[model samples]
Target: MKSQIRVVWALMWSRAAVLRSDPERGEITTTVIVTALMAIAAIAIIGIIVAKLTQKANSIDLG
Candidate 1:
C-alpha cells in the first residue's frame, strides 16, 4: 500500500512537471485519462471499506 501510494505520487508529480515545463504541449488527453483512473480507484477503495464495515457491523452480538 505504501509503495502504491508512492508510485501514484510520483506519477502525479511527473505529470505536473511535464505541464509546467510545456504549458502548450496539449497534454489534455493524458491528464483526463489519469484523472478518470484516479477517480475510479477512489470509488473502488471506498466501496471496499464500506463493505468491510457493513460485514463487521452485521456480525456484532449486540442484544
Candidate 2:
C-alpha cells in the first residue's frame, strides 16, 4: 500500500515540475480566466436559486 502511494506521489511531482518549468502563457491564462468566470456564474446562479426558494417558503401559509 505504501509503495503504491509513493509511486502515485512521484508521478504527480514530475508532472508539476514539468508545468512549472514551461512558461506557456496563452493557454494557461485563458484557462484560468474561463474557470474563474464559470465559478462566478455558478455562485450567482446558486445564490439566485437559494433566494427564490427562501422567498417561496416564507410566502407559504403553514398555520
Candidate 3:
C-alpha cells in the first residue's frame, strides 16, 4: 500500500509539472478581461442612473 501511494503521488506530480503553463496563462487572461469589463460596465450603469436622477431632481418644483 505504501509503495502504491508513492507511485501514484509521483505520477501526479509529473503530470502537474507538465500541463501547468498553458492552462494557467489562459485562466489568468480570462480573469483579467472579465474583471476589467465588469468594472467598466458597472461604472457606465451607475453614471447613467446618476445622470437621470440629477435631471429629475433639477426639474422638480418642491415648493
Candidate 4:
C-alpha cells in the first residue's frame, strides 16, 4: 500500500511540473484581468444607479 501511495504521489508531482512549465499559462492571467475589469464595471454601474435613486428620493417635498 505504501508503494502504491508513493507511485501516485510521484505521478501527481510530475503532472504538476508539466503544468507549471506550460507556455499557455498567460491565458489564466488574461482571464483574471478580464474578470476583474467586469467586476469593476458592474460595481460602477450599481453605484451610479444607487446615487441617482438617492438623489431622487431626497428631492421629494416632505412638507
**Best by TM-score, which number?**
4
Clashing pairs in 2: none
Model 1 whole-model lDDT (C-alpha atoms)? 0.95
Residue 12 local lDDT, model 3:
96
| Model 3 C-alpha lDDT per residue in residues 1-63, reported as the tens digit of each score | 999999999999998878775556478788999999999999999999999999999999999
Per TM-score, what order, best first? 4, 2, 3, 1
What would the per-residue lDDT of candidate 2 be over residues 1-63, giving only the tens digit for each residue? 999999999999999898888878468789999999999999999999999999999999999
Itemize residue pairs with steric clashes in candidate 3: none
Candidates 3 and 4, the one with greater TM-score: 4
Q: What are the runs in model 3 whose C-alpha is more than 4 Å off?
A: 1-22
State in Å the error of residue 59, model 3.
Answer: 0.5
- Candidate 2, position 34, lDDT: 99
**Candidate 4 C-alpha error for residue 15, in Å:** 9.9
State the displacement of the C-alpha of residue 13, model 2, in Å, after optimal TM-score superposition: 27
How many angstroms is residue 12 displaced in model 4 relative to the true structure, after the best TM-score fit? 16
lDDT of 3: 0.92
TM-score of every model?
A: 0.59, 0.61, 0.60, 0.63
Candidate 1 TM-score to native: 0.59
